[model samples]
Target: MTGWWCASRVPKWARAPIPRWRNWWPRGGSQGVRSSQDYVRKAGAAARMMLVNAAAARWKVPATECTVERGVITHGPSRRRLRYGEVAAEAARLQPPQDIPLRDPKDWKIAGKSMHRLDIPDKVMGRPVFGVDVALPGMLHASIAQCPVFGGKLKSVDASVAEKMRGVKKVVREGDFVAVVADSWWRADQALQKLRIEWDAGANGNVSSETIAAMLRDGLADPKLPQARKVGPNIPRPTSTTPPWSRRPARPG
Candidate 1:
């Protein structure tokens, strides 16, 4: 087994039917399952090989003669069988085999098939825990208000009304944003809505898509614009040309 495989014998106090994988690499979205499936499959194969070897040693037979299915190892000649849990302790002590061959895609029972997600049951039952569900003793919640326009600054705020609201602890103002802190998120949000705030939109107050496009076009036309990479002596620099689509003016709405 590679370092990726962290399988070990379950302690007496925490004995469970299934083996647990620990120390997962941090991943987000679908990439977690997509990127790690091969590693997971290989780790599982290595762990299975260890269990088969353990069963073989116990039955005094060659490991090759043992067959495994669903968590059971069987010896065809002697008709001996052992559950994964039965040999887990011994298997945990054995060194994992390397480069275990993956099963043929034709023999796959689960992969590339539509199967129910393990987490769906908990989610459907409203038993799943999310980040927002976490609560700590004496924890406070906050709601923030930011400028609606780009390049805007907080000019002034009259937070007297919000500060006096029930459960509102504090009304804080920073350079470009304001926030209300309270015992609960709802209280903070409600208090935040009551605050009277003024903003300075600065020079960008009247900026529009047309102005932004003009700025981009001006930047692109600058000869002094920094080059991200230098061209090699043998390489020729391509002539710059504006795309036909960008040359067209925006249509009036």
Candidate 2:
């Protein structure tokens, strides 16, 4: 049987056919899909036109004056031109999504090109702010301490000494885990290091990866094993692929 198409092979321009939602705003806003395709078509056209117009206006030139060439933008007499990067901030502020108009098909230059990311330079220079880099005044450090056993319960916790420790403000024990909030990450980590957790070992306490694998092997050996797949109305025998454990057999053949 043939395999499914890879996601990358799918055409981006060819959109999934879905029911268009109706625009109820024309006669006092309500809700529902549009009965006709005309409105949707007009809106799409208008948006494209607005973008081009907005770009031109932002650069302080007429719609016909500036042209988006390649990824860069150019304006003024043919010999003298500037990259879109130079004026993107101003152009973006001017567009404001709702206020700007898209360009007509004939007026487009940059949009037609295969688009690429605009923030590559910022990322390479490590100037972008990610979640991990976020900093706030008076913010405290926090870390999680998970239960040792997969399904175990925490009987109780004694944090009398931990609370008195330097930089440690409080110890929070909730559900099956505990967290120590402190002035700094080093202090929180140190406090957590000193914690003595009392766990009631459940079913998974002694269950290691090897033990689970043995159980799975026994299950696979059963003739009554449920069929995960039936290809072409026939049961395909499992192939013998060399597993790392199988290499060191007790009695080598």
Candidate 3:
């Protein structure tokens, strides 16, 4: 749910046989599933509805007559119902359909332009659950220190002092990437400051903003420089030496 760490090795829970179902569940809470349509939030509510339908099937009730509302599965005519969670044990015994029938969009209660968003309440309350909000027991925090320049590599790293710092768990180094793991994020940051790292200057070692501006000026003056998708004929760019205010007024011909 937090990335791919909790994925089932054997995927496809809905199509899997009764015994082989991997008990798939999503841990992203409400905000993790980013569907603009508010139907399915986390565990594919449609599939969960199907599980309710599967349970109602055992009672010889037609699925068309059966309706699921807020995890409660209700049968028609008799109005007999059971919470979906109550029938989960029984649903596990029954195999899912080979071809699951989709609910008609017109009949869907939640599918409409006027349908209200589900997360608006949580967002207003400032408690909207997101992937970054995930916190588990015994979870470790990691912070990475990357090279300043792109495509740059670390020439050398001295992390001996960082290792001895408070709450510093471990220091990992791979190519230009260096990470500090610790008991807390702030402690790891403190440890990072203790370490001294040297980076290998790449091709742009001597390059600066001034050098780039010069290159642009040189390219503008080149008559052979191919014109890109321009709207009109190319005009010479203003030179650094010729300020607009300092230019002499043009004399009449």
Candidate 4:
């Protein structure tokens, strides 16, 4: 006699449901759903903006000339069709938003469904053209130096050795900041490395975190501090007995 045995292959995770039948909600739960709703509500707006911006990367289309409808993008007159995904790819390479009149809602299509963002690939690939990513011919690198203390005045700076450094273009000193300009960041940094700046430090120089805490505590301790609220006509007027500076003087006498 032969005995029959059944064999089955089971997944390692099949032994139990995740959370052991706790009926846990999916990740992103309510908040995720809300955020997603917000994203959808704004999707058309984002697409409307991106369509024209992306169009310029390829051809001249006014922002009002292009729109996203049903995941496809249409440019004005030509009715040329593109996927939002495609537009997003093109837009990731484009400059920051410049006004192109946007298509109004009455003229829209493709904006309502939950679809993935068009710029995802560029962001994932680290190829997004952000402000810091812009490159122009003859562009120079710049870094700012400022007084470490508030309201400090720059005394003087010695740039003799710094001026001699290779690749140093110019040292620009504005009221509160000094910019070391050069052909390249490394060179600018090198140029600044040789300079020394002095400033007239202000009152906060000797102030520490501990002293600030004490001051805050003392301010809070003064009951008058709360009554001194600057907002609205409800502010309590100072009485004659109050400090001279706190009360308006009676007359010139």
Candidate 5:
């Protein structure tokens, strides 16, 4: 939307009442979305684009005559123009359009092109701010601690000392994970360190490095056994050769 309005020369005032609706992502979404291929937008985004075109119609120009770009909305070859920010209030007052023109591949311009992304400039300047950077009034910080040993269950936790510590707001334990909420991140970390926790190692208590090496040695000698990288508990040891991939230094985070 910013790109479209900017090309149209939309003034600051014309941008009023834009984003009056919440931009909410629904649950059940992929939490880790780092690449462009993982991107997903809701149906509301489509409706918002329709509203942009509908706003132009309210100004006596049909969508076909108007070109919205860089916050500006222009009409006709002579390029008679109105900024989107100028029409924002009136646009908010108008009813939403029932339908929008379905975009044809022929109409595509910027999307999927090799052109520079909108956020590149800010990112290059180290000035980009993300959602996680937002700070609300009286908002607290949290620190989480997870069990280091997999398959181990949290047996007990004593939080009385943590609760009495200064700046410690709350300590929460759910399943094997412990969360510390405090006035600041440092305080939360302090509280987390103070927590006295015990874990039930169960069958894992018997597992050891020597045992793992022995299992690895056995796994390599067996011919019919399926090849695998990890030698988890309960897998019968077949040979001693260490996995080739383990020879490399650990990958940095």
Candidate 6:
């Protein structure tokens, strides 16, 4: 109850009180360390408190008198000691306390220090699985071709040749692109290359450097255009500004 919702996924009958430490990392920008560390710290403290409460109940002492260190709880007055694993079952039954105070940074043993990365061994041994490494039983591969010109549309595609190519499964065409599916990526790529396709290059296809330069010049001359910055009123405008290309180059000595 004290931890995040995902803590519920941890089985109550687990042999040890362990936080879901793996979920702390940011995955696909979903969460950052700054945001996750607080939750993890609080949840871990709550779990430790539960174990301490369970041990205190067995010893017939107040939970506050118990101190936890390295998974072992010790009662100061009675000299009683209990391992977290020994009280894990009873602790699981107890409702987690709310708003457990985090330990002081000065007392931290591992955090804010260099330590061995848990993922290094698996990565070095090439044992870690990735998205590209996964393969399914009947998975197909596809190769796509998009219009070469900007603002162009797909006009026509003669897929008869590509459809008959070896290992080619299907040929699909959309508004601006065509795709060839096959048993393998290479076969799909080969089939896609064989297809005869046409694209309708719209008005933008005729755009050239001269047209772009003219547009920039028009924008600079327009008084209605938004000014990037106006430090003060009554700023003097330059009578003329030399274009970079129009300037003569220095002669060789």
N/CA/C clash count, model 6: 0
lDDT of 6 by residue, 1-253 (tens): 2232323333433323434466542344645445456765766777888988999999989988988776678999988888777998999899988768888999776667775667788899998777656679999988999988768889999999999999998998988899999999899999999999999988787776677767776766677843522224555333334443555656421
Candidate 1 versus the native: TM-score?
0.59
lDDT of each: 0.76, 0.57, 0.63, 0.59, 0.62, 0.75
How well is each residue in 1-253 modelled by candidate 5, as lDDT tens digits?
4345124222343433333336642333563222211111222223345545665567666667776666666776656777666676666566544453344546656455566557778888877666556679999988888776657777888988888988998998877778789998889989888899887766677777778777766666666654453367557534335433455645421
lDDT of 2 by residue, 1-253 (tens): 0011111122222122334347322422443223323333344333333444556665556767655444344565553354444554554454324443445657544334564666788999998887656779998886658788778877677777777889998898977788889988789878887787787667788887778778767666676755633233477546333334544645312
How do the residues 27-63 of candidate 1 rate in per-residue lDDT, one tens digit apiece? 5687855765676666667778888999999988999
What TM-score quantifies how close candidate 5 is to the native fold?
0.46
Error of 1 at 53 (Å): 3.5
Residue 249's lDDT in candidate 6: 52
Full-model lDDT, candidate 1: 0.76
| Model 4 spans > 4 angstroms off | 1-114, 223-253
Please count the clashing residue pairs in each candidate, in the order shown. Answer: 0, 16, 0, 3, 27, 0
TM-score of each: 0.59, 0.49, 0.49, 0.46, 0.46, 0.59
TM-score-best of 1 and 3: 1
Per-residue C-alpha lDDT of model 3 across residues 145-240, encoded as one tens digit per residue: 988776788888899999998888999897877889998878888888888998886876677667777777777667686463233576543455
lDDT of 5 at 195: 91
Model 3: CA > 4 A from native: 1-57, 61-76, 82-139, 209-225, 233-253
Sum up the clashes in candidate 2: 16
lDDT value, residue 60 of candidate 6: 88
Residue 239 of model 3, lDDT score: 50
What's the ranking of the predictions by lDDT, best on top? 1, 6, 3, 5, 4, 2
Error of 2 at 185 (Å): 1.2
For model 2 the TM-score comes to 0.49
